[model samples]
Target: MDIFDTLDDTAIEEEALMYDYLNQSARKEKIVRPRVDHFKEWDSAEFHRRLRLITESVEYLLFLVKDETETKTQRNQYISPMLQLLITLRFSATGKFLCLYL
Candidate 1:
């Protein structure tokens, strides 16, 4: 008769676990993911093939947006402008959001 009656036990348990995780007292520390230097890793041909732009062109775009994209505060080391630009271009070129994380 009620909404609780519709959700199975597994669903109810999962919801409870998610609620607990969201309300945990101790904040989890930020994860420091290892960064790959794409500029160094990919050759000019490979970079163009993947991202649809040569490294030099990417650099030029980065130079334009570097001032705006840069994090003003030093509290956390944010993703670099170059990396942001690369991720965006990769998404634009391939239309795959998962590629950004990989």
Candidate 2:
């Protein structure tokens, strides 16, 4: 199974919450959706909320990874594989965001 598929239900829930928060923040801050004639006014709190959500999400992911990686047979094997997976996932996610932004 894919690394993402290994994420438990709690992780999925947190990820969903993070996405929702980010989307809401983007909508309010007009970062993703520009303020057109019919668009809503910008709100600074939305930006803060988005930042909070992102911070929390990162913490959650780190915790999950740490907890799983602690039982490794050797540090080398665990870290390298984990790092590679994390890097791949990070790049994929970043690429998607870049596409959306562009």
Highest lDDT among the candidates is held by which one? Answer: 1
Where does model 2 exceed 4 Å of error?
A: 28-102
* Error in Å for residue 36 of model 2: 20
Clashing pairs in 1: none
Which residue runs does candidate 1 get wrong by more than 4 Å?
1-31, 98-102
The clash number for model 2 is 0
lDDT of 1 by residue, 1-102 (tens): 999889999999999999998878567777977789987899998899789998889999999999998897755666878888988998999997454434
Q: Model 1 Cα displacement at 98 (Å)?
A: 4.2
Score residue 59 of candidate 2 by CA lDDT.
46
- For all predicted structures, in order, the TM-scores are 0.61, 0.26
| Residues 5-48 of candidate 2: C-alpha lDDT, one tens digit per residue | 88999999999999999888877442343223211232444422
- lDDT of all the models against the reference? 0.85, 0.49
Question: Which window of ten consecutive residues has the lowest lDDT sum in model 1?
Answer: 93-102
